[model samples]
Target chain A: NAGVTQTPKFRVLKTGQSMTLLCAQDMNHEYMYWYRQDPGMGLRLIHYSVGEGTTAKGEVPDGYNVSRLKKQNFLLGLESAAPSQTSVYFCASRTPRTSGKNTGELFFGEGSRLTVL
Target chain B: EDQVTQSPEALRLQEGESSSLNCSYTVSGLRGLFWYRQDPGKGPEFLFTLYSAGEEKEKERLKATLTKKESFLHITAPKPEDSATYLCAVITSSTLGRLYFGRGTQLTVWP
Candidate 1:
């Protein structure tokens, strides 16, 4: 099974350009998240969705917006990209914990490397 | 403020050498600690989870243990294929799904 899959494994964009990264998961998890990883910095959450039609801001949400149009897919969009936005993006999904919140055991996609020039 | 710190930013070991990676955190209402391994160009992969102090879990060449303020990921008899960046994260609050992560310990095992 494709646990979690992300599209556009690699991309290069000019400054001010716009793009979208797609994430799909077959685990039927209730929670999905978007994160970016940089050197010396662990994965930081960009945005997340608790379920379909619901999205919330995360630690680094300024340059990105997310939508969960379907239960199995989460889309991350950069309306206007910047050079600082270049980073490796990852998508993760997990079943809820006993308290109904995601408790750290997450399955992740390979990652999408975006280079903004 | 919640913080997670992992020590030995990087490590290099020979095949069969054993070592451990450390993850320390400070947060209120600790819920769980998680360990993940990420290969170059890949996303982090789940390794283990520790809910409370003294808890331990084992996989083939890895073992994870937790305490009130820190967690350890012990790698026993490593191989080149086992080299990867190891990440540590903590689920601090029950109301939020956010997992605070550390910088991670990058390991390289030379065969």
Candidate 2:
């Protein structure tokens, strides 16, 4: 069972270029998230979707846009690449939120490395 | 602001040596704490989740214990395959699905 998968494992883009990273999950999770990891900083959230056709901003959403057209796929778009946006991006999915339990375990995809020059 | 801090940015241990990694956090209302392992060039993988103080979880050779203000991931007799970065995250009451993560501790177990 392919839990979570990401496309374009590696990419290089010149400044002002645009690109999209695709993430697909087969577990039928209701929550999906996009995060970026840098050298000394831990993974920071970029955007998230609670379900199909729903998206919301996360901790670090600047210069990034997200779409969840289908329940199993979440796409992250970089309208204009910048040097600061060069990092390893990860996609994660989790089960729906309940009252106060249900261990919030996130199944993550192999990261996509993007370099903005 | 809610924050998470991990100590010993990196660690090196010989085979059979045991040690612990620390994750401290300060938040208004804590809902849950999570531990994840991440290899180089890969995404973080889930390890354990603690909901309240004095909670403990064990998997293979790793043991995670939680307190009111911090958590500890203890590795016992680790092998080379146990080398990875350990990340700690906190879920607050205000945010339902959001997680705040720490810088993580990189561990290397040498044989």
**Per-model CA lDDT versus the true structure:** 0.91, 0.93
- The regions of model 1 sitting more than 4 angstroms off are A98-103
Candidate 1 falls in which docking quality class? medium
Deviating ranges (above 4 Å) for candidate 2:
A97-102
Clashes per candidate (backbone, < 3 Å) = 0, 0
Query: What TM-score does each prediction get for chain A alone?
Result: 0.95, 0.96
User: On residues B14-44, what C-alpha lDDT tens digit does candidate 1 reach at each position?
Assistant: 9999999999988888888999999998889
> lDDT (0-100) at residue A74 of candidate 1?
99
Q: After superposition, how far is residue A94 of candidate 1 from its true place, in Å?
A: 0.6
- Models 1 onward score TM values of 0.95, 0.96
Range of the 10 consecutive residues with the lowest summed lDDT in candidate 1 chain B: B91-100
What DockQ would you assign to candidate 1? 0.70
For lDDT, the strongest prediction is 2
